[model samples]
Target: MTNFLERLKSPGDLKCLSLGELKQLAAEIRERIVETVSRNGGHLASSLGVVELTIALHRVLETPRDQIVWDVGHQAYAHKLLTGRLDRFDTLRRLNGISGFPRRSESPYDSFGAGHASTSISAALGMAAARDTMGGSEKVVAVIGDGSLTGGLAFEGLNQAGALKKDLIVVLNDNEMSISPNVGALASFLSRKMTSERFVRFRTGTKLLLGRIPRFGPGLLGIVQRAEGSLKGFLTPGKLFEAFGFEYVGPLDGHSLEDLIETLENVKRLKGPVLLHVLTKKGKGYPFAEESPALFHGVGPFDRATGMVKPSRERADTYTTVFGNTLVEMAEKDERIVAITAAMTDGTGLTEFARRFPGRFYDVGIAEQHAVTFAAGLSCRGLRPVVAIYSTFLQRAYDNILSDVCLQNLPIAFALDRGGLVGEDGPTHHGAFDLSFLRPMPNLAFMVPRNEEELRRAMVTAISHDGPFMFRYPRARSEGLPLNGTPEPVPIGRGETLRGGVDGVIFAVGSMIREALAAAERLEMEGIRLGVVDPRFVKPLDRELLVGAARRAALVVTVEENVLQGGFGSAVMELLEEEGLMARMLRIGLPDRYIEHGSRSELHAACGLDADGIARRIRKVVGADTPVACTPRARFTRG
Candidate 1:
């Protein structure tokens, strides 16, 4: 009912408001988010948690000049409001409104466009180093949540930040949460130290005073540091970060504006790569958010007052749910089955599996690289490791996935969630390149399930089968069939012909499988014999099935939600060339252009990966033979 947020224009206006006014502003912001996101679903919990912190940052730091890089920029809703984007705030994550994360094109204040985690510290340090190199006076700050700290990149940045010892401000927003509750021993230690304000003050003051004084400072500080390390080990946790050469400071209350401001100011003035740990509660102000922060992490449309999420009417089962439920069933049957998620137990559909089998479940917080190696280690021993992760995020650990898992031929099931156009989350979130990247890897078997039944079957086959195996699924729901299928073991490196035809065979991956099937049915109606093949594994090439299909069909069309270059289509083209089958080849996928924010259907239609688009491609290939009523617009726009 109130438009108080509209009244306040800039950070300067926000600065003039008193503490009480700021609290009211927080409420207003939440109200606006609920109103907007309920109508247009976006990240709820993360944005909600950062409200006060966002206000404090704007109030303390000069914007557009002082670069602040937010790690995994989903929680930048408040940051957006304070910037010049409040006017267009109504159209968040729409066709052409505003983005969910920070974008360079969106506004000047957004220092970097980030949807991935564990990048803030590294990126911010880069900006800081550049500023120093150019002899600039702008401040460089990185706001990273605790969950993101699980990422090795953050540690690599921390190590560099410490070694470089440049004036870099790395603020750890310790909400004891980031997507999921902070896990691992390091998270627990940081969280404990965060609440221990008295201890932090004592250690920092001693270090600053002792580390200074020029001549004897190094020797004296060294002795004192060693002494403190031993003394603190008894009183506090081990100092893994201090050894990294960072001036680690408090686990201050992030929610308390006064404390946050005071601590930030204290660290701001300090020089030579300082680390300030600010403790805050995720979904602090709102009760529902406070109670179930994970649910609110990146939420959809919901009933604001009651904090009730709107149930989807589509009734289709998402690929994630299919994977998750299938995993639980497999784990129940076999004791060797274990699951791993990179801080996405809830997102990856492993929550039920986690609940059912606590010991087997491993939620490696925001650390894709670690999750891969960890799974590899599990595989080395006799245990089956299933690393379930989003496609885009999984790319962060490409080297690890290739070298550790694939090269070694570890029997790990990579359940790729949101494998295609993820919709609204934009280019950063889309798992578009999985098929292309994974297809080339050695000892790897990749599959894309058309429906819930295949998704379950793939997981079941992966669990029992040896060597590295992966299967991708979409962000949308399942086939509403409750994963009904005979538990048929997946024939590795084999393609199944969904519909038989002599005209052409459409080889589609994951989400495209459904569309390819639909296209087959459409052609069938017109008395055109079109064949559909769901190539279960990409790496192996399904030689027997594919060769037989190609021999019979006049054309081979490969459909995937990835780039044409080095993508599934590229693989198919390579295979055809190798086999000496110069049949007409058609590729369908996301364009070369970086996809913008839009709904799933909108993005699919635009990219021409939908059923209609798939059919058009099929028609183009087979249409050449017969007079099919169609006009050919370039279905794919090259990047």
Candidate 2:
């Protein structure tokens, strides 16, 4: 048979296929996904689980005209293939290639951009409202996973949509997993809804018996419908949804192609807000993914046959492992020490923390805002809470971090992981903005570690501190540095001078310190003497070091992995302006624009943050004889 997937140019092509052809297409999509993701390594289990669901949606709805907003976009592999992007599928998650998540800019078929969780229903509701206003009769659907429901935003979106009573379809894809296993009240409720044997038996039996009546069958069905609320309250778990003003449908099998198509077709004809509960397996097609969905959720390149990740190059320890291990050790000694995460137990390396100190570990389930405030509440009772979350996800809790934690001067420490350009996941996952956003806030101490040892030291400093303290580290591994047996607290707002120079001074922070040092070595080849300083704290702005460096060197350069605006560079620039320094300044960091998905090396080179780029730029700014260039690169000039 000719490959149906090859002919599938668009959703319009999908509509022309038979049910059997559609199943074959689904199989082909799964194979292509397994092949591509085996090499590229992305959200494998989630995408494989949603093959049938994706096909059913595209077949039922006229996409582009009709919008489908996918939550998190973790399961968008099949959607990407169906929406005229199959040829470019090989480039998924590569530098300047197709994104792993849905990007509105990339395609009109992608109704909304999603990288973060629990935003799809809101986006879809907004689209539905816009359609009503414009007198457009387009259908809008939001496919959300059960994991997203743990976050309060999904309910907020549900509440608003329910009250508005708009024609919106919210498909609840309940796969019983979310990176880690699903937890909390909502997960239990959904589980009850999915596994209620009594409800299933009663509902099926009632429908069958009613249809058997010759003359009074239609009237009997109407009578049963009228009494459904009272009758279903005892048997079904949909009463909760009924309270929210959404017409609840299903507990349907997400893998059943025929059932999904028929159900979706019928649901499209119905009125107000509808919540269709779908049951699916996370890694539906593949056995290895089915066995350990969490491991394969977002993986590196792996063996397709054996399902083992390709052996990584020998390197130093990752920042996540160091942070997790150190925290466990600290928590063992201090009874007040507690750990919290937002459904990233494994990703954040908190699996051991959860194992060793289960009583102290809290997995808040994709809720960053709740995690912060919860940590603050813990702090109020004299418990020291360490909230470890990815840098990008932490942005969701900015207001909470400021108002609840910072304003009250709580002693909750934030261990921000993936604190720089997290390659492949792209702009949404990058922790570039944490320093920029947190810098202006009062009563908060920010620290970035240069290596594993420094990470341990910073962790110690944060724990010993009395108020809100944050320590950020990159996604990359440590520089194979050794850790001292015991962690020592470094003085707050202090910086270490790695090298001294008379020509120019380079003030680097965190991950940039290594690159800055390399850049200095390259500059020396051209007889350009450049100094390197690791200003450990971004918030406190190492005043004495900045003033002294400015006084000693004719040219001053600030380097960081964060963006220029309101970041480490901005803090230095403010200090230089305040101290009345006559030294020339250049800030090297991420540009004003949002960076695209790529490797860290690719992004670093593109942003001129790599060693070679830094060396070239430093030499350009500070010539052998002259102090400052007559005309500086417009982008690097902070002022």
Candidate 3:
């Protein structure tokens, strides 16, 4: 409704605005976020929800110098808009515009870069300790949500912060949510706020309270002091945090700017660590978000006028939807099958599974370590535990996956959703490295499906197997190939030829099957018949199929949507070496660096992994076998 966004160049500019104008500014920011996000697409509800809080932090604290580290950093969109990036906001999350999350390189205000969750406290503590070491005096505050508080890393940070006794501030942004509703012990404790109170026991103990009584004698004070030890316990419920050795404040009104600003300034002075528990409504300015905040948490492009998001119809079914439907169907037949997620039920497509088997489904907050170990514990009790989690978040539980599940060699199914590049959310959200990490783990089986039908089959195969297994799929929606049939298990550790020829060979995995097929067709048109193989399992490579494919062609190329170093292609290279199928080889995948933010299609095309890139690589690798046009680089490489 207004161009107030132009007037705001930085958080520093807001100092002169009255509280009412500040509140209005919060609305304008939310409006701009909704308007832009509805076209560009981004984390909608979380940004809307944090409007006033972001404003209050800037309004109260000295940033960059003071250091405000946002947990997860997805909610930092408002912070970005306020901190001199509003003019460049159109480039938000686009390649080399401005990142969706805080990047130290992007601006002076972004004190730290973050995309992962539950890491703010430790980061802030580090900065504080650095400040102490440099003898520079500046406030370092960590803004963490209640959802993040559930993660073990956050607690690890909290525990260490308590022991370090640094002058650090941890703002517990408790809307009681972390993608899904917040779960775990800390959230439950924060919600039952201020029902208990404690008397300021004097510097000593109960003796002081009784000693202060005008008529009490010293002899009687001794007896009362002994009783008071147990008496104080009855009144004060949780010094759970105070036990960790820090002053605890709030469970205050987070929306009231005056209260927030005043309370923050007051705690800003208190010595040692302090937790200000500020409660605010998520989706504060938007009515639709207020009504169903979870759905709006990370929204797609939508109509701002009616609050209706346009649906994606490029493909028949999303990979997540297929996975969720398969799990639901399996859970229906098998009573022992259980599900686990790290605070992502709907996002992982386990909503139906959770709804159908509420008793069996465990949404373990943001604690990925706990979820893995918890599933392992369930497996010990003869339950078939399927952990439905995103690929990126799973990186957090590497230790848990190794020590808890893989070490035991239990029959746990790791349903890794969003297993490839997740567009726009950027590098932190990309599912590019699960292959490299999981492949080397002992007793772990890794695989991916070519399409939805194969995914259904893979699910059945995973459930039927007796040891730990993992299956990953892309974030892109399925190619719309119908299920066409019921659940059927494909043989474990086996892959088959999708198409075959004698020219150069292309071995692909997961969603790359489509790319492989497209590349093959392009080659065929150019009189270079290419062989295509889908090695459904990246681990335990289809030895016979791979060797046969290698022998038939003069050159071999392995394709995957993962990092090139020690990934699926590397596995194929090892196979070729062992078999002595010394055909010239080429590798195509992500490089040994962080891929920047952009639309998946744009990144794919630029990296030369799309249909055309794959076809060209195939042509270059098979230069001697078939005469083909080549670029100067390709010609030199071939020569």
Candidate 4:
């Protein structure tokens, strides 16, 4: 047989292929995805699961004209292959490479960009509405996973689509799993396999037979339809979608090319909000992925044959691991402590906690907004709730964090993981704005931990405080220092001087402290003396220490991993200005623009946040161009 994948130039080529050829192409696509992801480290199981469904959709629909918005675009790797990206497939998620998720700027086939979940339906509906306004006949479809359906935003889109009564298609990809096994009533509802093919055939046959009857055929059909509504409400999971004014289709086999293509070809002609329920297995073709779908959902590069992840060069425990262990230890001593995650039990390092204290753990689905308020409610009942969420995902619940938690001064501890430039996943997943946004909020204490030990102490402080407290940590490994003693609550709004210098001072936050220290050491060798200060709390800043440091040093610099605007650097600048300090100052951080996807080291260097970059900037600012004889090292101080 010929190589269908290599010969296929675009989605239009799929229309010319036979069903057998399409199946072969799917096999080839899976091979390509597995090979690439095995090397590149991407969303494996989700992409592999959607191979057949992607082919079927591209085959039937006139893509580039007919829009298909994919929810949480990780599952659209097959879609990327089917589009004109096969040549560049190897570069997925790499710096200056094709994105892991659908990017509108990258291709015309990608109607809308997606990295986050539950936005597809609304975007597709908006496209459909625009098409209607312009009187265009283009078909709009949204392929959403059962997991994404659990988000409240998906339902909001559904509610609006039902009322507008536009011609739209919604492909419900029921794989029965999200990143973690899905939770909530919607997951349970979609899991009911009551609407089988046999039931569908029987219902169709009965309707046809009744229509064939004499003059009373119409009356008999009406009675059967009314009865069927009640019956479907009891038997099928699609009654909820139907009640939302959609014409519900079968729960068809998503992997069956013939069934998918035929059903899609027929459904394309239907009008007014049609939902096609297609059942699929997560990690369908890959054996290893199928066995542990969640593990492979968003994985690093691994051995494709043995299904083992490749070992990293860094041997230290990740900040996430430390957080999980510390939380579990803390929970052991306190019964009022409870943990909550918005469907990221494994990612947020809460799996062991959930197992150890099942009753106190809550996986609130992909509902961050609800998770915040729900934690607030839990706190109201005298329970200590720790809402663990990725910094980027927590942005979705900013309003809730402000109103429900901060404004009310609730004692809820928010552990924001992935608090800096998360490599590979890119701009959509980067946690660069947490400090900028949370800094100005009232009645909230925000802290950035420099290492695993500091993170443990920050956790203790957050829990001990009687108000809304949030702390952020990076996605990288912790500094290999031993986690020696029991964590204790540190004084709030305090900073410690790490190294003392006479010429200049550098105030660094969180992960940037390492780079700052390195930069200071390098400057010392070049006859320049610099001091480093770790401002633990960004919110209740140590004004006295900061003002005193500024008064002593000729030049003061602020560095952080977040964007420069409204970030840690800005906060320092504000403090210095208010104290009437006239020291020459420079701020180093992420650029004002959205950062592109790249390795953390590369991104840090690019944004001048690395040791060398920081040194160069400081030298340039202080007008120190020539290197002289080495000077004595600055005095090292802990506090």
Candidate 5:
């Protein structure tokens, strides 16, 4: 009941607490986590699950010297609290506050930066190798979840770490799920090893039998370990790890503080690569989270007492919902249409699609590279596969997209969701580079939808197109328009002018259209009349239309949600240069630097991409002073 969490300033302070007190600290930590997360909205369940493990590790090891790398870093809230960040914990995920994930630049205790999963092992191994080279003795450990192991990179790190035979400790935190339930062969193997009753009995009996063999029991057991390797392999999950040259140590009780501290102390003294397999509940302390961990995985704010999220008054559907609904509708009409996601069935809004047509749905289990190439394979067999993934995650499969899809000119529909500043997920998840990276690939058509209608139209256009096609939508809600259900194909390389003016023109794309129009409305009050154009396609650049618009206006401005470098604005400038038309131009978008965590509106304002910011920038381009008294028309909301 005492404020133990407030008193503890550093990991060194944890050394003074008794096992009972440490257990108490774990409870307090979980309470604090739930309280903060209920208001702030963050990765809650994972953080709650790892409280004990986090305490145990800090208790047993000397941190800041002994490195602890967390895979994905979403579950390190307890670690953050113990390491001098408790005071700022309230500001988690807010703009300019402490990050939800680990950042090496933010704190020295954070040994490595992580937002995405499955890179912990490699980073820890590298640190271990570096320590060895310098002739130093600081323990290095990587705490990885079972879900993170689903990635190929984790195994790649394991392979190299095993071969190197360096002193490294890997903590495999088995929570039976990632963001969603675990899938694939690795999940099956871990599950089989954990649940086999016969294997558990046999393993226990063999160890007891070996202990009873007089004076020679210990030495003989050690020597014949490999001779009995087959039997042990059949009986334990750790046999696979043993083969990789690691000293396999667990199947431990992760919730028991005494057992965890004791086991970690033992493993800390061992030499060479060691792996301690820990079993923990995904949402341990909280009952509601325990019942449905997936819903609480990366949750929005909720009522702490009832665990119920307040009903949102937003009547509009998000872009993801529209995509999912449209995809199912289209699939009903076209039997050849199939959907794919990389273990993000619910997050990607394919839950309805999966329930309606299970056979046509494929969840690839966090393997984006495989998802893209697999979609290509599906295309080869005359089936149309649409890969719906977050723009940030899709960066992982760029090679496959370029080689297997674009190079081959396959009919794969790439539906990129979360295509702009994803807010609280931060720089790691912001889709700032997709336009720049995706523009150069040959035989690819790029489109950014202005609203729900345009998104549906683009979806239809992408599905019907012969070559590789990409359409991106932001992470916010749609325009709340009534359903038309008709799929109209937008003419390629052409822009539609929404408002006409003689002084200047504003070219807007995707989510920025509403803001651009609002800025134009504000500027009109000051006698600065500006025209607006919606260039639906980013790749084709709409050369003729854009050049003609630029030539007529004294000033031209391009607005997008993407970064300035090699973005839609760059495409517009290059087109103007080609036609030898020189005009005063300004590009309004995200800055070259990585945008930090915040609400989308706050980030938009910070980056000068919001309506007021855009209006000021436009007024500066022309020689018009700010209006003294003006009532701009009702703000332009998307139709």
Candidate 6:
């Protein structure tokens, strides 16, 4: 058989293919996705689930002219394949390659960029409004998942889109899975197994039957129409969307290209906002993905045949694993310690904790804003609530964190995972701004742990603290250091001297400490003595240690994994200025631009956060000729 996928140049090419040919093309797309993802690693199950839906949409709609905004964009792999990116599909999620999510700059066909969820409907509505204003004849559609509907943002968008009644089509792809199995009332509502198409056809046929029965039929038909609204509400999921001022249609098979194409063609001509509910499996084609959809939701490179992930060289426990184990251990001792996550039970390392303390655990779906305020409410009721969320996702609840938690001085412990340069997912998923944003918030204690043991202690300290506390950790594996005794809370606003030197001092935060120690060791070999200090808390500086180190040294360096602007480095600079220290200072961190997707080590090296990069920068500043081999170690004198 000829390769149908190879013949496709653009979405317009799908228009020429017959229905049988389209089904063949979908199989080819799935094969290509599985082959590429097996080597490159990406969102596997979600993409496979939406292959037919993507192909049908492309076949029916004139894209670039007719905009289709995809929610989250992880499931857009099939969309990417159909839309002129077939050749570049192998480069998915690689450094300097095509993005894993939709990017507007990469292609005109990608109407809007998306990485985060629940923004598609709002974005598509804006595009529809723009098209109306410009008097353009373009159609606008927002392809959102049932899981994304759990977020409040999707409802907010729906509320506005319904009010305006714009010429838009919102396709709700009901696969019943996000990162995990979806939660909350919205999931239950969408999961109702009522056949909406059968009911809709019955309603249509009854209306025609009633209209044809002379004078008495008109009055009877009017009464039945009014009663039909109530009957439809009781029988189908469409009632909820119909109440939102949208013309509700379907509960149709998303895998059926003919049905999808026909429905999409009919809906394209309709005025005002219309919603098409499409039912699809999370992993449609691949048997491995279909069996375990959540595991394959976002995956690493794996064995195509066995579905086993490729093992890394580093066999140490991941920071996520350590955090999960530690949290479970702590929760067992304290009943008041309740955990809350925004639909990230597995991702945030809280799976075991949830299992152990089922009543105390809460997965609040994709609503981050609600999760923060809800944790605050739990704290107010005298519970030690720990909000376990990714650093990037927590940015959505900044206001809730500042006003509801910080301003109220609630004792909420925030366990921020993925605190540094997250690999492969790119700028949207990078936790580069947490330090900068959270630093200025009052009544909040911020901690950064250097190793797995420190992470355990930090968790203990944050839970025990009176005010709101937050600690951030990276996405990498933990240092294989053995955990000693029970975790003990370290002294707040204090730092420890790892290596002592007279030439200069390097204040390193979190994962950067490892790089700092390596750089110090390399400099020591070069006859340049550079001290390394682990400043545990970013908000509360170890004033005495820092001042004394600055007084004795001619040069000082601050290193972090966050963006340079308003970050840990900036905090150190402000401190030195306040103390009136006369030391030449250097800051090493990510630059004030979005870093591209790559391995954590690659990103660290690119941003000069790696040990070799750190050493090269220090050597440039101190001059390569300076010999400090005979210099005495600077003794840290406490104030």
Tens-digit lDDT track of model 2 for 180-250: 22322333344344334555567668888998899998789878877866554543456888788887776
> Which model is ahead, 4 or 5, in terms of lDDT?
4
Tens digits of per-residue lDDT for model 4 on 419-446?
9999999999999999999999999999
For residue 66, model 3's alpha carbon misses the true position, in angstroms, by 0.8
Instruction: Record all residue pairs in model 5 with backbone atoms less than 3 Å apart, i.e. clashing.
Output: none
Pairs clashing within candidate 4:
none
Q: Whole-model lDDT, candidate 6?
A: 0.87
What value of lDDT does candidate 5 attain over all alpha carbons?
A: 0.86
Better of 4 and 5 by TM-score: 4
Per-candidate Cα lDDT values, in order, are 0.80, 0.87, 0.81, 0.89, 0.86, 0.87
Tell me the spans in candidate 2 whose CA falls farther than 4 Å from its real position: 177-226, 628-639
- The 10 consecutive residues of candidate 3 with the worst lDDT sum are 630-639
What would the TM-score be for candidate 4 when compared with the true structure?
0.92
* Candidate 1 segments exceeding 4 Å error: 1-4, 177-240, 482-486, 523-528, 618-639
The backbone clash count of each candidate, in order, is 8, 0, 0, 0, 0, 0
User: What is the Cα root-mean-square deviation between model 4 and the actual structure?
Assistant: 6.1
Clashing pairs in 2: none
Candidate 6's TM-score: 0.92
Candidate 1: tens digits of C-alpha lDDT, residues 1-639: 445578876777876777778778888887777677777888877887888788888877877788889999988988898787888988999998899999988989899989999999999999988998899988889999888888889999999999999898887887763322233233334434443556567877877887787888778889976775665444322366677787666555566676666556556666688776666777776788889989888888888778899899987766787777778877888899889998999999989999999999999888888899999999999999999999898898899989999889889988889888888888899888887777778888887777888778787788878888888888997778754544788778777778777667788877778888888888888876778888776777788787667666667778888888788888776666666665566788878878888998999888888888888766665656652221222443334
Root-mean-square deviation of each candidate, in angstroms?
Answer: 6.1, 6.1, 6.0, 6.1, 7.4, 5.3
